[model samples]
Target chain A: MLTLDRHTYEAIVTHARRDHPDEACGIVAGSVGSDRPQRFVPMANAERSPTFYRFDPREQLALWREMDDRDEEPVVIYHSHTATEAYPSRTDVKYAAEPGAHYVLVSTRDPQEVEFRSYRITEGVVAEEEVQVVSALP
Target chain B: MAIEVRIPTILRPHTGGEKAVEGEGATLDELLADLDVRHPGLRARVVEEKGGTNQLRRFVNVYLDDEDVRFLGGLSTPVADGATVTILPAVAGGAGGVAGG
Candidate 1:
């Protein structure tokens, strides 16, 4: 199971709505080997296409370096699906390099509802996991 | 000191099951070539010769010191000793045709 505080959860949802039509993506950094997300970083979807997203290469580089300096890692990698259920597509499974991170997907297809889900994609395998939204860090 | 290349799990076979390998090159292209010399067929998976030019395959994302080489300078991106270069397959964004709007 994956756990997130309400603030972080809302931040992801807001970013998803802000980038509606175009996919939104970002990373939540956490202490190395901690597996707990503590930092939120909303990234620019380089593709900026309604059906696609890619991190701005330069921005990703800089941010990743910053995380490295802080001894952190991308514990939660997230993206939005505007017209489909929150789930990992085949491509998403194919490119999941961080076996230790949570892959979160938020679907805003329904005007009144948002489908939030998490998964662990490792070696072409996609395993949906439970998400617990907490009021504060435990 | 040599540059460190972190290989993804899928590509571990080429490196004799090693997750990270050492290579030497002034540029990413040269580094891949050097790696190919040792691993023999590893570069083809990460790069391709297209339209009379060598380009990183669409699915491949290579980062030099956490910065993507595509934005830094593509294959011509320079590398210094002790840099940590990572190669990962591109996910979600353009992976396997779009599944949603």
Candidate 2:
């Protein structure tokens, strides 16, 4: 199960809805070896396509360096889908290289209802996990 | 001179869970090849032969110090002593628009 603070959860949903047709991508960085997501870091979608999203390489390098300096890791990797449900697509699964991250998929297909889901993708296998939203991180 | 290469978590398996390693090469390709000599199967995961030529896998990002190798000479990018080579898997992917539910 992935436990996230309500603020972080709301922030991700807002980012997804704000991007709307174009997919939004970001990560929540946490202390190394800590599964808890504490910091929300949104990334530019270099692809900027509704069907595809990629982090800008320059920004990615910066992120990595900063993480290394801070001894942090991306605990939650997230992206939005404009026309599909909140699930990992074939492309998503194929590119999921971070085995330790919780892949979160948000669906902005519905104007009124946004679907938020989390999954663990490792070794080409996708396993959906339960998401628990709380007022504060424990 | 040896080039310092930082390995990401996803590719650490190929490096025996090493976070960083060193290799000698004048070019990025040579560096990776040199590293592969010690850590087998590491290069194959980051680069693949395409159209009879070696090309980086689409989902992988490699940098020579701060500049992305794609902007330079790619795998043939020149690397000198004390350069830091970083490897990271691209964080990407999205829906194909098939499932609307």
Candidate 3:
């Protein structure tokens, strides 16, 4: 299961809503081996197509390098689906290379309802996991 | 330089169901060519001609040591011995419709 603060979850939903039909993608970075998502890095959908999303080549390079320099890994790789269920498509499963990261999918198919789900995609298999949204402020 | 290339399950057919294969080259392009010699039609699926130039397919991503090759000089990226190369299909799909719910 993956756990994150409410603020982080809200941030992801906001990004998905902001991008709307084009599909939003980003990474939540955390300490290596920690499996905790502590930082959010919103990414540009290079494809900019409603049915597809790809990180900008240059930006992805820089961001990944930055994460490397900071000794962080992408703990959660998230993307939004504007018109579908919060599920990984066959293509999504095929491209999942990070075995250790939680793959989050948000569905903004309904403006009034947001569907947030998470999964683990390793090799050719996908397993849905539980998400614990906790309040950080106290 | 000898490098280990992690083959995705969909592309494993090209490697005779092998999950990983050995490749040798000074750069990614040469390395791909080396693999093609062993597995015919393997390069065509991953490589393509776009805008009159040959390049990796838009939907195919190749990474060297966790770094995407596109930002690392693309096909010219230098790959050293003992490095790990990963190949994946670029996956992008969702339901279809206009914006705003």
Q: Candidate 1 or 3, higher DockQ?
A: 1
**Per-model RMSD to reference:** 3.8, 2.8, 6.4
- Complex DockQ per candidate: 0.37, 0.60, 0.23
Highest DockQ, which number?
A: 2
Write model 3 residue lDDT over A54-114, tens digit each, in one string.
Answer: 7765566566558767988889999988878999987677566567789999999899997
Model 2 per-residue lDDT tens digits across residues A1-138: 999999999999999999989999999999999999999998989987888898999999999899989999999999999988999998899889899999999999999986999999999999999999999999
Per-candidate Cα lDDT values, in order, are 0.84, 0.92, 0.82
Q: What is the lDDT of residue A99 in candidate 1?
A: 81
State iRMS for model 3. Answer: 6.1
**TM-scores, each model vs. reference:** 0.80, 0.97, 0.69
lDDT of 3 by residue, B46-69 (tens): 888777987887667788987889
Off by over 4 Å in 1: B1-21, B37-45, B49-54, B63-91, B94-101
| lDDT per residue (tens digit) for residues B4-36 in model 2 | 999999889888899999999999999999999
Q: In model 3 chain B, which range of ten residues has the least summed lDDT?
A: B92-101
Is 1 or 3 the stronger prediction by lDDT? 1
Worst 10 residues of 1 chain A by lDDT: A56-65
**Best candidate (score: TM-score):** 2
iRMS per model in Å: 4.3, 4.2, 6.1
Question: lDDT tens string, model 1, A1-138?
Answer: 999899999999999999998789998999998888999999988888776788865676677668878989899999998887888876677667678889999887887897999998887888999999999878
Model 3 alpha-carbon drift over 4 Å, by segment:
B1-27, B31-57, B60-101
True contacts kept of each: 0.38, 0.90, 0.31
